[model samples]
Target: MAEPTLEQLREQIDGLDEQLQGLLNKRAELAQKVADVKIATDGDAVFYRPEREAQVLRQVKARNTGPLDAETIARLFREIMSACLALEQRLKVAFLGPEGTFTQQAALKHFGHAVETISLAAIDDVFREVASGAAHYGVVPVENSTEGVINHTLDSFMESPLKICGEVDLRIHHHLMLSEHTQLDKITRIYSHQQTLAQCRKWLDTNMPRVERIAVSSNAQAARRLKDEWNAAAIAGDIAADLYDLKILHRNIEDTPDNTTRFIIIGHEEVPPSGEDKSSLLVRMKNRPGALYHVLKPFKDAGVDLTRVESRPSRSGNWSYVFFIDFEGHRDDENVQAVLAALEREALDVRLLGSYPRAVL
Candidate 1:
């Protein structure tokens, strides 16, 4: 057989591209048909399913045997599905934001760019939006690997009637950015969110010890402040930097290299069990000796793997506390049901936050 010429290779590539485009449109048409069938059966049928999406993404990854990496391929398909889902019913996602915050990035990361995002000023606002059906879902930061739990988010859950639908883990990368008006030698102050400042504490202390550190409401707010302030820099993520058009003075300034934040998706509907899922619980026990032990004993007895347990002062009584517990199993699982039954028997008050699909990407 003769070796294929460059022209022949180009022609083959062009033919494959045409086929791919046609197949993509066919998939889209099928998605439209699925939407029609759902609407015909029920007027208010839910268009998004976190469990379904998780299973598809996992299958896409497991079925891949390609030059493209798993995560890369998974992302491409996620966007494709996101587009198709939007065709059914465009989703609205609310997140903690002034427009360019980490929570917004997390929301987009989980829901994809096809959805419309509503940026709210506070985490509670995000919760309210979802609870009121103003947004299909909300994304709020629950914890940072370096900074421990976000008590605010946990406290919000104490009163809110929302369920955890999904989870997203975003690797945080903070950059020291400056406005065009400022130069490195001229910088005299640094600004960032309180948690962000703490996350990059050692880095700031070692390099800019003399500069005054000020904490703002958010990283995006800090980035926006740099626009008019000539002698200042902001420690923010790429989304904020790009939004504010700030020049990068330094990148990845977080003290810990692997610093990541976990954001939970809040919605009105409960997520079904994906093969891999995690459940959260809020339990309040009588403030007495062995109360904590009793709370933990069930998980051990049931053989359920507890992922996290954080205590917050109960709003009801003095010295009383509510524990926010996370574990590695779906509520429908037999072992998890056993644990919940044990807690219900012993605990003064208990609430299942939700069982949700764990973060896949």
Candidate 2:
């Protein structure tokens, strides 16, 4: 048998494209039907189901066999689901920003670009917006692989009644950018968020040691400042660089190549189990010698895997401590419930922040 000619292959590709388009439209029509059914059943319905979306993405990734990688395939389907959900109701997402920040990128990644994103000045404002019903959900950075934790984010959760509905892990790439008016030889000062500066500390020390480094409210804010300054450069990411029309002086200048930041989705609703899930809890243990041991004992006994455990100073007392814990299994799971019940009897207070699907993409 002869191998197919180039013309024959092209014809086949075109036919497949047409079929894919037809199927996509049919999927969209079915999504509309689902929305109608939801509205008919409940006047107030949440179109975006985090657990359901997570499960879909997971299945997409699992079943993928390919010319395309799992992540690429999942991302394509994510946009499709996002568009479908928009037909039902567009979600309002709040993120810490002046716009063009990594938090905004994470929100778009988790919720898809179809959402109406509002950029707030601070993390607390993101929480307040979600709590006040101004936004349906909020995205805020919880921790960075390079940097230990985002203290402000943890503190905000202390007082808010919001729950973690979903999460996204974004690989951070800091770029040293400048405006068209700036001269590389005359650069005297640099601007970036404190975390960005810290992430690129080694690079900055070796290359621009003499340059003055100033920490700003956010990397996006730093990029904005460069628009009018001729002697200043900003350390930011691609989004900010593009937003401010800045030229990249250097790319991926972060000291750590695999630097990643984890952002959490905050909302009022409690997400149901998605098979593979994680739960977060804020626990205040009585100040005692074996406080830490007692707090961890329940999980150990219940055979739950603890992913993370971080301590923060409690506002309730000068010497009191509050622990933020992340563990495998949903709160609704039998093992998790037993663990929580055990903790309640011993701990001063235990607040289940949420049990959400783990990052699938």
TM-scores for every candidate against the unseen true structure = 0.96, 0.96
Which residue pairs in candidate 1 collide?
A: none
TM-score between candidate 1 and the true structure: 0.96
| Deviating ranges (above 4 Å) for candidate 2 | 1-9
Model-by-model lDDT, in order? 0.93, 0.93
C-alpha RMSD values across all candidates: 1.5, 1.5
Q: Candidate 2 lDDT (Cα, whole model)? A: 0.93
Q: What TM-score would you give candidate 2 relative to the actual structure? A: 0.96
lDDT of 1: 0.93
lDDT of 2 by residue, 1-361 (tens): 9999999999999999999999998998998999999999999877889999999999999999999999999999999999888888899999988899999999888988888999998899999999999999999999999887889999998899999998899999999999999988999999999989999999999999999999998999999998799999999999998888999989999999999999999999999999999999999999989889999999999999999999999999888899999999999899999999999998899999999999997
Tens-digit per-residue lDDT, 1-361, candidate 1: 9999999999999999999899999999999999999999989888899999999999999999989999999999999999989999999999999988999999888999999999998888999999999999999999999999999999999899898999999999999999998877988899999999999999999999999999999999999998888899999999998899998888999989999999999998878889999999999999898889999999999999989999999999999899999999999999999999999999999999999998999
